[model samples]
Target: MTTHLIDKIAWIHLADGRVLSTRSHGRDRYYLPGGKREAGESDLDTLVREAKEELTVDLDPFTATFLGEFRAQADAHPDGIEVRMRCYESAYQGRIQASAEIAEVVWLTYADRHLTSPVDQIIFDHLHDQGRL
Candidate 1:
């Protein structure tokens, strides 16, 4: 099977025991705030760029902390490819707003696992194992 490296960052805003998530345009499932890295871009750069494009918010790279790496199949794609998602936690400025790429924003609790994307499900699993859920 072919594998693709997808560097992703999760902006975990834990407030009132919930996590913030976003739905991209034309995508049904909700995901943690993040995107893939462009060529020659660092992991932090990708997170910052994706957050700006999708959420219309600026992420403080300095405040960004590396969480952990996740590997999963790209279930949303036609080809059965694998993806490596590099997760992170960070602080940002401005209210959450959906931009051209994003359709909606929501805060989900750990109990709402069914609403997340396949990859996000794995993330939730890890978070739960770590007692962060």
Candidate 2:
């Protein structure tokens, strides 16, 4: 078996034990709100840009903290494609509204893992075990 790596940054915004997730245009599953890093962009830079693009919010860099990294099959991609998600917990400004390529914005609890992608399920489990989701 072979695998292709797709690295992405994810933001975990928790409020009342739920995490913020997004459904991109034409996508069925929900995913953590963030995207891949661009050329010359730092992980933080990717996160900041993605959040603004997908959710219309401004992340506070000073309030950003590394949560952890997770890997799993990219369920929506081809068989060999895998995604490694680097997650961050952060505080942000403004209401979260779906924008750009995003179709919907949702807040999910641990039991809602079934609605997310495989990689996000891992994140959900990890956050659940830590009592943060």
Candidate 3:
């Protein structure tokens, strides 16, 4: 069997014990605020752009900190398809609201893990175990 990998970047913002999550237009599962890197774009470039496009916030690149990378079966994809998510935590400017392809923005606690994609569930677990969520 062949295994395919999808590379993605994500922002992990925690506040008041809840992590930020977004549901894209017409999608049921919520995911962290970030997306795939464009050609020749660094992780910071992708993080800043995706944050603005999806959450209407300006992430302070100088304040961005690497969290960890996680991998799991891609949600709604074939059995051998997986997603590798590189996550970061950062400070940002402006209030968060659904923008661009995002349909909704919500703060999720550990108990809400079931509503997220497989990779996000792993992220939630990590945050929970660290007592951050």
Top model number, lDDT: 3
lDDT of each: 0.79, 0.91, 0.94
- Candidate 2, 1-133: lDDT as tens digits: 7789999999989999998888988888999999898899988999999999998899998889999999999977888899999999889999889886888888898889999999999999999999888
Q: Write the per-residue lDDT of candidate 1 for residues 12-128, one digit (tens) a residue.
A: 655776778988878788988887777898988888898888888899999988878887766586556666778888888887898877889998888998888777888888877
Residue pairs with colliding backbones in model 1 are none
lDDT of 2 at 23: 91
Better of 1 and 2 by TM-score: 2
Model 1, TM vs. native: 0.88
In lDDT terms, how accurate is model 2?
A: 0.91
lDDT-based ranking: 3, 2, 1
Greater lDDT among 1 and 2 belongs to: 2
* Candidate 1 positional error at 61, Å: 1.0
The per-prediction CA RMSD against the true structure, in angstroms, equals: 1.7, 1.1, 0.8
Error of 2 at 59 (Å): 0.5
- The residue pairs found clashing in candidate 2 are none
